[model samples]
Target: MKKILLTGATGYIGSHTALEFIEKGYEIVIVDNLYNSDISVLKNIEKITGVLPKFYEIDLKDKQNLEKVFKENKFDTVVHFAGLKAVGESCEKPFLYYKNNIIGSLNLFELMLKYSVKNIIFSSSATVYDSTAGKAPFFENNITGKTTNPYGTTKLVIENILRNLSNHKGLNVVNLRYFNPIGAHKSGFLGENPNNIPNNLLPYVMKVAIGELEVLKVFGGDYDTEDGTCKRDYIHVMDLADAHFKAFKFLQNSSKKIYEEINIGTGFATSVLEIIKMTNEVTGENLPYKITDRRAGDVDIVYCNADKAKKLFDWQAKLSVKEAVEDQYKFVINQNNKNK
Candidate 1:
């Protein structure tokens, strides 16, 4: 069995990917600091896959504890997902974002090199694209390094770092530039559980549907789209997990040193109003929302050309946005029942 190291494995996407790996019969070692996630997700994973992953509660920023994990386990690949991800928080505290995302990544990469783990799949964002270039269908070769926020800048810088490492140190890197990921595992055992107010779309919508929040604030409504609302390539989290697994397999079979950036998203774009409509249809609850002024740094449309992922890894999103909404609603209802 291939031994994989999943950073932030207790978090939303990480936990789901852990299930995918376990189901594929891979041994996974998880390392998370429990900052944005809870430790009980391990139980959820066990419930889903009937396998408990070896876990370490070590922050990637702590080089000492992180290196200890590397010393003990010989990993075949590393799927990196540990970082501060809030865009507004990143802007308010750029130092925190840089120190946590960039420094922590540096420590992890150094340890990977020391342990001779040459294969890695990095969790990147489509925000690395130059939104000023205007609109969706962003390809891998599109202009980058024109990010409008600190969160995106960190991802761009990290991609550059990975590119340099791949060129000089013979490291094989696959940068998965994800569009908006917004669903739950189909089992309803795992899903995004943000501690605070969600910064993303679907989570916020779920909150309103569950009566956690009063109303959803639609950010922009004057964009150059059919619905006048900004459109995004919202993909299911499970599909994103499959993309990671396929990318890792791609690296495992490659004979040459490689640094490839691939877009992982559904080629279709959905507007905010469309999401609200879907949520209403799924939960049978009329979601309350308000159209507001466009937030700063907001783009008109942000989707991707996922043909590269299909051509390279034979991966495309199989689940639709409607299906994602249904699964996410199921997860919320399951969690509510559990808490009650």
Candidate 2:
């Protein structure tokens, strides 16, 4: 079995991916700062997978501890999930995004070079896509330069760094550009755990259902979308997890010359209002919502062209939007009562 190192292993996506990797018979070790996540995720993962990752609780910016992890264990590949990920918060504190997302990642890359670990799969976001371009879906070959927000800029910058670094023939990198990741593990034991207020729509709707928040807030209902609101392709977190696992398979088999960037999404657009309506259907709750002014830097409509994943790795999303919401809602309610 290949030994895998996962950063931000206790995070929303990392937690789910950990379960998938463990099931695939990989020996996993994790490193997380716990800035916006809790250690209890390890327990949930152990319960679900019967194997807990070897964990180190330290900030990614801490070079001393990072070096120590590389020295102590042999990691064949790394799937970096460690970073600050709130869009609205990233705008307010752009430096934090750069430091944690970019500089911190540079530290990891340096360490990878030192340890001769050349393979990496990055957790990138679709926010790097050019939303202004006319399209039903964003293809892998689409000209994707104009990113809207600081969070997106950070993702784009890191991907570019991978491209340049790979040119040296020492590293092979895969940037898995993810769409809006929703849903929980089918067990409902692991799901999106936002640090504070949920920035993503699915988590926000779950928060409302769980009584942590009062109502859903639609940013705008006057856009040119089918529902007059922003539309996004929300891939299930589990499907996102599977895509990462499959991408790793491709990387493991490819020559060192391969450095690829692929999109992971359902290629199905769901509007803000449609998300709310679906939440009501799945959770059997009457949702309260009000249309407000559009949030700054939010794309009006964006779906992914997920064909690349199918052609490249035979991976595509299998769960529908409603199935994703159902599992996510289960986690929110279960977590809400525990907090109280």
Candidate 3:
């Protein structure tokens, strides 16, 4: 069994991936500062997987403590997921994003080199792609230097650093450039729990349905699309987690010391209005929403051509948009029941 080092292990995607790894019989060592997540998620993972992962409450920015974690455990692969992710927050505080995302990643990489752990699976975003460059359904070969926000810039920078390290430092790096990931696990015991206000649509919609938020603020309704709203490829969170497992297995046995990027998405575009409709269907509530002006850095239509992920990892999103929305609704219902 391979021992995996999962940074940001308590966060939304990280928590689900931990469950996936545990289910696959891999020993997981989790490290997180709980900056954008909760410690309660550890309990949730244990509840579902029946095994508690070895966790260290260490921040990646703290090189001394991070090194201590490396000295304690033997990790076959590192799934890098620790970073500040909100685009608006990144624009407001670019320095914070740079320090946490870039500097923290630098700390992790330096420690990895010292510990002789080379294989890594980086959690990346489709924001690295310049949607203005071409049509929708972006592929792996797409030119992606241009990004709209500092958050996206941080991901691009890390990808470049990993690319260089892989070539010169004998590192095996696979960057999974994911599209919009929504939904919760089937258990509803684990899901996205954003610290502050959610910038994503699905979470905001769920909050509105549960009466936590007043109204779902639809960003833009005048973009160049079928419904004049932004279109994105929303994949289930479990599917995204499954892709990480496949990537880890591929890296473990492969002979080539390669640096590669895979687009992880369903390759199907769903519009904002369509998402609203689907969420309403699942929640059984016609929640209130208002169409507003376009937010800065908002793209019209951005999905991915995930042919490479299918060919390379034999992975593709299996859940439909309706199913993803239903999972979110189920999670909200479960949370409300818990609070009561």
Candidate 4:
């Protein structure tokens, strides 16, 4: 069986991708710091999959621990998903974001070179595109240098680093630029369990529906869109997880020509009001939300052109928005009951 080292294995995306990889019969050894996560998730993953990956609570920033993990595990591929992802928070503390996202990655890449693990799949973001340039359905080579936040800067920088690494005779990669990742596993056992306030729309709406938070604040309703709210390409987190598997397969015994950056998201775009309405429909709760001032760095519209991913990996997002919202609503109910 092929083995993979997964950094940030307890994260919103990494946790689900771990399930995807395990389901495909890959051996997984995970490293996570649990700085912004709960360890209870490993139990949930075990409950759902009946297989627990070897877990290491090691921060990627600690070069010593990363070196130890590399020395300890013999893996064929490394999926790097450990990074500070909150856009607003990245702005407030660019140093923290750079330290965790950039420097931590540099350390991991150096170790990958040391250990001779040349295959990697990076979790990139669509925020790297300029919201002002061409329309939605963003292609790979469009206005990437115009990101409005430090989070996007980190992703872009990592992509550049991975490119440089690919120059070596062994290292080859696919930088998967993710669109919006929302929803929970169908089992209601594992999902994007954000530790403090969530930075995305789906979780915020779910909180309002569950009464965790009283109101969903819709930021900036004056945009040029159908509903005057921000438009985004929201993909199901499961789809995102599955796409990683496809990309992994694409990387399996492939030509060097396959080393490229790809976008992974649904081509369809949804607005904030549509998402809120979906949440209400899924939860049977008419959530109370009001439009407020636009948060700085918030894009008016952004989506991805995932045609290349489909062509490259024969993978397309399969879950509908309704299905994702339903799963998320169910998971929130299960979570609330567990807390109670």
Candidate 5:
């Protein structure tokens, strides 16, 4: 069995992807610092997969401790997901974002070069695309490098670095620019568990539904959409996990050193109000919400033209937004029960 190194493996998407890799019969190791995620997720993954993956509580920023892990174990590939990801927070502290996301990624890349582990699946974001450059749906071929916040800027910079570094004879890189990811695993054993107040829409909505938060603060409600709010292509977390699996298969069959970027999304735009309505439908209660000013660095409408992912990987989202809402609600209720 090929062993994989998963940075930030305890994170929301990383944890789900770890389960997927295990189910597909791959041996995996997890590395996370528990910055934004909890340590208990490791147990949850073991509960679902019956295999407690070897985990390292090391940060990517700590090069010495990180190097020790690489020296001791051989990794066939790496799925890089460690970083500070809040847009507003990134705007507040650009330097911190650059240091944590870019510098840490650079350290990891250098280590990869040293160890001769060339294959990688980078966790990129749609924010790297300039929404004002074109229409609603962004394609892989669309020009990037225009981002509104430091968090996205970090992703853009790392992507450039990866592209340039992949020019070497053996390095193979696949950068997956993800759209909004929501929902939880079907078992309710794993879900989006942010350490602090949630930043993403689905998590925030879940908090409101469970009475942890009084009202869901809708970011903007006067955008150019049908509901006068921002619209995004929110893909389910499990579907996002499946894309990583497909990417691994695609990378393994490559004959030459190649660097490819693909967008992973559902290719359908759902507005802010639509998400709230969906949440209400799942909970059977009209959750209280208040429309607020548009947050800085937020776009009006940004979804994906996911044809390239389908053409390349034979993968597209299988879960519906309604199902995502239901799964998210279930996870939130489970967590609430645990706290009580």
Candidate 6:
């Protein structure tokens, strides 16, 4: 079994991917600082997968402690997902995003080189694409580096660094550019539980349904789309997890060093209002919402052409947005029941 080191493995996508890897018979070690996630997620993962991954509470920016983890575990691949991800917060604190995301990634890459861990699967974002450069369906070969916020800038910079490393250092890198990921594990035992107030749409809508938040704050409602709202390609978190697993398999079977960027999405666009309506339909609650002004660094429409992922990894999203909404509501209701 190949040993995989998963950074931020207790977070939403990382935790789900850890379950996928463990169930696939891979030995997993998790490293997380618990900045935006909880430590209890490990217990939930064990409950679902029946295997508890070895975990270390170390920040990626702490090169010394991170190096200690590298020296302790001989990992075959690293799946990097540790970073601050809120776009509004990234704008509010650009320096924090830069220092945390870019510097931490550099440290991890340096350690991977030292440890001879040549394979990596990066958790990139669709935000790295230039939203104004083209239309809705963004392809892998589309123009990038015109990011709207500091969070996206960090992802683009890391991709460039990884590309350089792959060019000269013979590193195998796969940058999986992800669209909006919303949903939970089918077991309802694990899901996205942000530490603070939620930033994404589905989480906010779920909170409103559960009466944790009074009303959803819709970012914008006067865009050029049909409903005058921003449209995004929301993919199921589990499908996104599967993409990581497939990418790892692809790397393990590769004959030579390669750097590939692929988009993992459903290729179907849904609007902000449509998401709220779906949430209401799934939860059977009138999810009250108020549409405010347009947020800074937000585009009217941003979806992806996911054919590259399908062709390369033999992977495409199998879950529908309505199904994702249903799964998310189920998880939220289960959590509520557990608390009660």
Clashing pairs counted in every model: 0, 0, 0, 0, 0, 0
Which residue pairs collide in model 2, if any? none
What is the lDDT, from 0 to 100, of the residue 169 in candidate 4? Answer: 47
TM-score of each: 0.98, 0.97, 0.98, 0.97, 0.98, 0.98
Q: Report how far off residue 255 is in candidate 2 (Å).
A: 3.6
Better of 1 and 2 by lDDT: 1
Global CA lDDT computed for model 6: 0.92
**Tens digits of per-residue lDDT for model 1, 50-167:** 9988999999999999999999999999999998899999999999999999999999999999899999999999989998895568999999988888999999999999999999
Local error of candidate 5 at residue 73 (angstroms): 1.0
State the weakest 10-residue window (summed lDDT) of model 6.
278-287
After superposition, candidate 4 runs with Cα above 4 Å error: none
Determine which window of 10 residues in candidate 5 has minimal summed lDDT: 163-172
Candidate 5 lDDT over 83-137, as tens digits, reads 9999888988999999999989988999999998989999999988887897978
- Candidate 5: residue 255 Cα off by (Å): 1.9
**For residues 1-340, could you state the per-residue lDDT of candidate 4 as single tens digits?**
8889999989899999999998878899989999888788888888988898899998888999889988888888999899889998988999999888999999998999889888999999988888778777689888888888889999999988888878754588899999899988999988878887898888888888988788889999999899999988989999999999998888986866446899998988999999988877776769999999998767678888889988988999999988989998888889989999
**Model 2, 124-171: lDDT tens per residue?**
988787877767688877877797778999999999998988997468
Against the hidden true structure, what lDDT does model 5 obtain? 0.91
Minimal lDDT window, size 10, model 1: 129-138
In candidate 4, position 139 carries an lDDT of 91
Query: What lDDT does each candidate get?
Result: 0.92, 0.88, 0.91, 0.88, 0.91, 0.92
